[model samples]
Target: MLQINNINKAFGTTRVLQNISLELPKGETLAVLGRSGCGKTTLLKIIAGLLPADAGEILQNDQRQNELPPQRRNAVYLYQEALLFPHLNVWENIAFGLRLRKTPENELKNRVEALLVHLGLQAEARRMPQALSGGQKQRVAFGRAIIIEPQVLLLDEPFGALDPETRSQMQDFYQKTAEQLQLSAVFVTHDLKEALRMGTRWAYLDQGQLQTYPTREAFVRDPKTGIEQEIEFWKNV
Candidate 1:
């Protein structure tokens, strides 16, 4: 469980987040929809402990973690770019975190190899990141993040740079991977359809305020979310 209470953030005089609060249950994905620069990424960064919140309580599984650093938070932040190490092959990239912790070489190899097969990337184990396609690269990135078994996965517009077909494919992969691993995730996006498709729980963030819906139907029908218009527009098309 990830608990956020009265989270606040500001840059100089401008407030980025205003008393934001939300709870994320274990193994649940909360899809957040917001406009650019509306503090979506800021919220994720706060939870991941990459950025400090002016005021708030961050709890993980009933433990207080507000003062914990990013490394101690056991959270991973992933952005749109794969940002994979160009110098490392797929095998090394996935095992990178494990090796950082100095896991046994055989254990690291086994874990990395298992993740490779799980992500259907065993054929590309020896290939460099530049040799892979967009979807494949994102898969590698995902594998790298999950191999360390972080408690929370914070994804910031991860598929925004992909083509429509690739975006959909990656979305499917994300859903399957999270479910299979029982990973808790917070996915931030601007696209309505993508949010609806990817999240088990839906929330809309506008001007630093967060609102969640009881169901997808409610999410789409709620006037404040502006998702109803998108649904109607697609129906007409």
Candidate 2:
């Protein structure tokens, strides 16, 4: 389980996160929705140990994670872009992390091969990043992240680069893959419909505050909750 307790972060004079708290169980996906500049990505980065919280604590399995660096933490972050290495072949790119850790040759080959099969990219294993489609590149990125078997997966608008048709396909693939891997995921997006479809429960963020709702229906129905207002705000942008 992942536990975030009263996380607070500030940059110079600007405060980005305030008293953010959340508990995520294994095998669950939580979607975070907010307007732009609401600090959703900052919060996700803090959880992934990429950014430090000015206050509060992040705990995994009841143990403090303050001492762990980003690479040491069992959390994977997928950015808005796939961020693949242009010079590396698909197989080499996916195996980069394992190689950095000095995994044996046989084990590395087995692992990369399995990921290629799982992501339906076995045929493109030797292709360069520029040769693959958007969805295929994103799949390779996902495979690289998941191959490490992280305890938490953080996605920051991972499908934003794809066209609508590809976006929908990738979303479905992500949902199924998360379930199959039994990974706890925190996905950040501004799209309400996407959040509702992908998340088991939804979190609403406004002005650096976080509130979770049990269901999308309940969240949309409550006028005073500001969820509808936030969605409208996103649409205008």
What TM-score would candidate 2 get against the native? 0.92
Q: Write the per-residue lDDT of candidate 2 for residues 1-237, one digit (tens) a residue.
A: 888999999999998899999989998888988888999999999988889899999999898997799988889999989999999999999998899889999999999999899999999999999999999999999998988888889999899889999999999998899888888999999887788778886788888999887777886876645668877899999
lDDT on C-alpha atoms for all candidate structures: 0.91, 0.89
Residue ranges of candidate 1 with Cα displaced over 4 Å: none
Off-target runs (Cα >4 Å) in candidate 2 are: 224-237
Per-residue lDDT tens digits for candidate 1, residues 129-230, read 999999999999999999999989999999999999999999999999888889999999999888988899999998888888888888888887788777
Candidate 2 whole-model C-alpha lDDT, 0 to 1: 0.89
Q: Could you tell me how far off, in angstroms, the CA of residue 17 lies in candidate 2 after the best superposition?
A: 0.9
Question: Evaluated with TM-score, which candidate comes out highest?
Answer: 1
Q: What is the TM-score of each candidate against the true structure?
A: 0.97, 0.92
